[model samples]
Target chain A: GAGVSQSPRYKVAKRGQDVALRCDPISGHVSLFWYQQALGQGPEFLTYFQNEAQLDKSGLPSDRFFAERPEGSVSTLKIQRTQQEDSAVYLCASSLNSYNEQFFGPGTRLTVL
Target chain B: AQSVSQHNHHVILSEAASLELGCNYSYGGTVNLFWYVQYPGQHLQLLLKYFSGDPLVKGIKGFEAEFIKSKFSFNLRKPSVQWSDTAEYFCAVVSGTYKYIFGTGTRLKVLA
Candidate 1:
């Protein structure tokens, strides 16, 4: 794709439900990132991946938040037992390399009810 | 830990007015600075970036920013702004290392 793309532009889940958001990065990009942005706040880093290897997950808020890029292209962020505090916009970005400029997707707005 | 600061939480100006948005970062080593804008309902887009070379960097849409080493600042400026320029602006910094940090963001509303 020309730019990063995310699926399920909007999602609503019950407090205890689990939700998965998908991201398709630019073709051949080697770096991918996930961020969560709360209302009126800047996007917070979640996790980072270099190709299929997960290198940085320090920013993940909790154990319930998981992300994976199995084939080095498409990625998924899964939240277990979603909570109201988890309601936010989930953004995905990809760069050709760790030092290169990143391209962002439209983002998935998740609402945990 | 590294962090970026944007003091202006919200700014409003009339069309054709000059614009200046402040950005600062706390880091001791080499850094890459960037400014991004997110229009209503749109994804974030790069406005300009300063990787190296001259401290002054020019970006798209007549936007430019200066990187001041002593001040630890990279302030975005434009001689004039259009209504379309109204958007949420963010300043970011990546230390010589790979990790990038972003400011809280400043919302600019250009009155047409």
Candidate 2:
């Protein structure tokens, strides 16, 4: 079975640019999560979605960060006006349910210059 | 605020040596604990988890973790680590909330 997967393994963008990272969760997964991992740091939860409903977005750092999971399958994390501070790896994970073990993706590394 | 702590930042050991990594969390309630491993160039994968029942839980690759509620700790252990075990290990805790609070992670280098 295919695990969670993220597209554009690497991305480079200038400051003030907008970037979108996509995630494809495993088939039949009902829960999806987004996290940000800075250099030498653990992943920090950014948002969570149950099916097509966004359950939590409190972890998003600022208004520039947005995420959506329509159709209950694919999810996207978009950062507007990219900043140097936003340079980090974006990880996506999915689980059968909220309590089940999550399967992680390879992550998309974004660099803002 | 819920947070997880991994005291060891890095560890180096020889193959077949015993390994133990410390993980502690600050949350005042029932919690679920998990250990995840990320091999170089690979995605993070689950090593084990502790939800309830026995405090000692065994995971894949001869790994195990002990959840001690009194200490607010869940330490991962392996009696004999292999060279292939070199990877970054993360400890995460889920409290009443559904999101996971992860530790900074410990990078282990196993010498063959």
Candidate 3:
């Protein structure tokens, strides 16, 4: 079975630009999560969705960060007005349910100049 | 303000050496603990988890973790590590919710 997957494995953007990272969770997964991992750091929670419903956005660092999962399977993390501080790996994970083990994707590395 | 702590940032050991990594969380209630490993160029994968029933749980590749509720610690250990085990290990904890709090992670380098 295919695990969680993220697109645009690598992206480079200038400051003030907007970037979107996409994630495709495994089929039948009901929970999705996004995290940010800085250099030499562990992943930090960004947001979480349960079957198209955004339950938690408190982990989002700033107002420029936004996420959505309209169809319940595909989710997107969009960062507006990118900043050098936003240069990190965006990781996506999904689970069969909220309490199940999460499967992580090969994160999309975003480099903001 | 739930947070996790990994005391060891980096570890180096020769093959067949015993390995132990420390992890602690700052949550008081019941919690779930997990250990994840990321090989070079690979995505993070679950190594083991401690949910209930047992304080000690075994995982893939001869890995295991012991959860001590009173101490607020879940430490990973391996009897004899292989060279292929060189990777970054992350310890995460979930308390009362699905959101996981991860530690800074420990990078392990095993020499053959």
Candidate 4:
């Protein structure tokens, strides 16, 4: 794809339900990232992947948050026992290198009730 | 701990008005600074970035930013704003361990 793409543009889940967000990064991009954007706030880093390796996940807020880039091109972010506070826009970004320009996806807006 | 700070949460300006958005980060090291804009219902687009060389960086859509290392600041400026410029702007810095930290963001509303 020319740009990064995410699935389920919007998701509404009941509290305690588990939800998964997917991301398809640009072709052959070596670095991928996930971020959480609260309403009226900037995106916060959640995780990073260098190819298939999950190198950095220090920003994941809790155990409920888990992200994987199994094939090194597509990634999934799964949140277990979703809480009201988990309601936010989940963004995915990809870059050719670790500290270069990042191409972003439209993001998935999750609403937990 | 390193963090990015955006001075304004929301700003309103008339078309043709000059604009300036302030951004600051707390880190004393070599870093890469960037400015991104998100228009309504759109993904983030890079406005400009400063890795090295000149401190003043020019971006698309007549936008520019200045990187002041002493103040740890990268402020975005435009001589004249258009109604189309209304969007949310983000300031980010990539420092140690290749982590990208972002400010809270500034929402700009340009009224015609």
Off by over 4 Å in 1: none
List per-prediction Cα lDDT, in the order shown. 0.93, 0.97, 0.97, 0.95
On residues A4-52, what C-alpha lDDT tens digit does candidate 2 reach at each position? 9899899999999999999999999999999999999999999999999
Clashes by residue pair, model 4 = none
Candidate 1 residue lDDT tens string, B1-112: 8899999999999999999999999998999999999999999999999999999999999999999999999999999999999899999898875566889999999999
DockQ of every candidate? 0.70, 0.88, 0.90, 0.79
lDDT of 3 by residue, A65-107 (tens): 9999999989999999999999999999999999998999999
Residues A65-109, candidate 1: write the lDDT tens digits.
999999999999999999999999999999989998888899999
Better of 1 and 3 by lDDT: 3
| Clashing residue pairs found in predicted model 1 | none
Score every model by TM-score.
0.98, 0.98, 0.98, 0.97
Evaluated against the true structure, the overall lDDT of model 3 is 0.97
**Model 4 scores what on Cα lDDT?**
0.95
What clash pairs does model 3 have? none
Give the count of colliding residue pairs in each prediction. Answer: 0, 0, 0, 0
Model 4 achieves a DockQ score of: 0.79
Give the C-alpha miss distance for residue B67 in model 1, angstroms.
0.2
lDDT of 1 at A53: 97
Q: Give the per-residue lDDT digits (tens) of candidate 4, residues A1-113.
A: 78999999999999999999999999989999999999888888899999999999988999999999888889999999999999999999999988778989999999999
